[model samples]
Target: MSPPTITENFVDFDIPQAGKPCKTWYTIYGDLGTSKYPPLVVLHGGPGMPCNYLKPYGQLASKSLIPVVLYDSIGCGNSTLLPEKRGDGTFFNIDLHMNELDNLLKGLGIEDEFNLLGHSYGALLGAWYAATRKPQGLRRLILQSGPASLPLWDEAQMDLRYQLPKELQDILDQHEASNTTDSPEYKEVVAEFTRRHVCRIEPAPKELQETFDAAARDPTVVLTMYGDHEFETNGTLRGWSSINELDKINIPTLIMNGRYDTAQDKVMKPFFDRIPRVRWIQFSESSHTAHLEIERERVMEVVIEFLTEDV
Candidate 1:
């Protein structure tokens, strides 16, 4: 079969703080205007990570004839970079991202009808947008490997950390206490944790590696919003929680995670328990990015079935 048609464009986005207009880079797989299904807007993880890692989802356009939209949130990737605003927590809050997503939808003219799928940090953004904005066009929701609350995430991660070897645990504690997360030793330890819970696939996929490189190049957004450490939360989003807001998500939602994901089952349970219409699935052998790991085909099949099934 021929490759799916792909189009790339930048939507002009205005940020009040910048005092000038910025652009949001986005890519579309398949023809949005003529597709029978509502376009699916994908939100990638890492407030700073780009959409490159989630590019695999583009397959939906060819497999299910569903238009797929992927965009880099402001302050990250092919979009506008705000290195000057680094360490400014107020400038890189979740509200900015929500507005960016809203602007991208309107900019694309698909705000009137679309399906939403967000992975990791993107899931948190998607849930907040759906619950608060209640965009009339949003038809379905998918929250993949995302935490329901920052407090819960921290607690779960700490539990996982304690399970690691004593020497590794001591190294993490020493580095965190010294505020030396930038050290190569600390980063290597974090990478070890990531391999076990984030992506178990050895020699990470090229797309996923691109995301890592992007984050390493300019960690402004992640540093301000998420923090220097992966398992800890000492950034702008430290106290954020969406447990109460889940009830507002009235649309059908799918929540999935890996049995070994950093987003533990407890972290994702609130969505399944609170969202009025929701289903949960767990990939036994996968980690955080199940779609790119062992269950790629199964992940695609489950998502297609969820998106296409009647309400």
Candidate 2:
């Protein structure tokens, strides 16, 4: 991995959220050759998290001669001040996040046309934009380690959570049942599940750990919708599934995953089968963050192949 060339200053703007307004900060990076390449917009995960961990994702500049924009959504990273916003589960709703994403692109004048790629929760936001708003000039789409439906997400997590040793599962069960979602035991169980399933990167990166450590719970968001544990979904998003809407996305789409990804094998196939113009590819040895886990050259080659197919 080569070091990134810091060339651009941050761009700031405000976008609409459900019932209020939020500010967003974005930056664009490029190689001189990018003058002729397609524009790519990268979306980071965490409905409430920041974009620091994937800062290394800027490496894409080495391969493309085009502009790639990356930004922190309203609440995460370098974005503006979060309100004394009550997490009451309503703060992290996908609809609000999707609106924030759309307004960000439109604010930056990229809404008309651009390649879309999203990771984890960001994937859901991207899909919502592409499907609902159907922004013009939209090119290709990439979904990495994302889920299409909350039910599916919940189901997959349940299966993965039990894979944890019996002792850990018992601790998790006790914490959830006793309404101790903030218990250290619950946090440990979540961390173990994350280490084994999410990134699988040994010596977890500092950026990611910081994000996890400072992660403020919008119990209102996770508890009301995504359930409390790996197998939970308690909010309106409990029915927030997208398998049926896959066909609504008529653009060429790439659905990818890592071999050891927590998203699992069963759930991804449905996205592939249902989306009209879709391709399914998995990194044979990688986990959730394949774009980082796999060699950069190899990942770019695959990305270029798909993005260039009908161009």
lDDT of 2 by residue, 1-311 (tens): 35435453444444334355446777676643335556678888755566666655566665544467777766555665454543545555776667676776676667766888888877776777778767777888988788887668777888888888999989988987898878787888888887777767777777677655444533233333344445566655666777776777888999888777876776677678787888888887776676655443566777777766656
Q: RMSD in angstroms, all models?
A: 1.3, 3.2
Candidate that scores best on TM-score:
1
lDDT of 1 by residue, 184-224 (tens): 99889888998999899989999999999998898899888
Output the TM-score of candidate 1.
0.97
Please give the distance, in angstroms, between residue 13's alpha carbon in candidate 2 and its true position after superposition: 4.9
- lDDT, model 1, position 248: 98
Q: What's the TM for model 2?
A: 0.85
Assess each prediction's global lDDT (C-alpha) against the native: 0.91, 0.69
Candidate 2, which ten residues in sequence have the lowest lDDT sum? 217-226
- Give the CA lDDT, 0 to 100, for residue 51 in model 2: 65
Q: After superposition, how far is residue 158 of candidate 2 from its true place, in Å?
A: 0.5
Where does the lowest 10-residue lDDT sum fall in candidate 1?
A: 13-22
TM-score of each: 0.97, 0.85
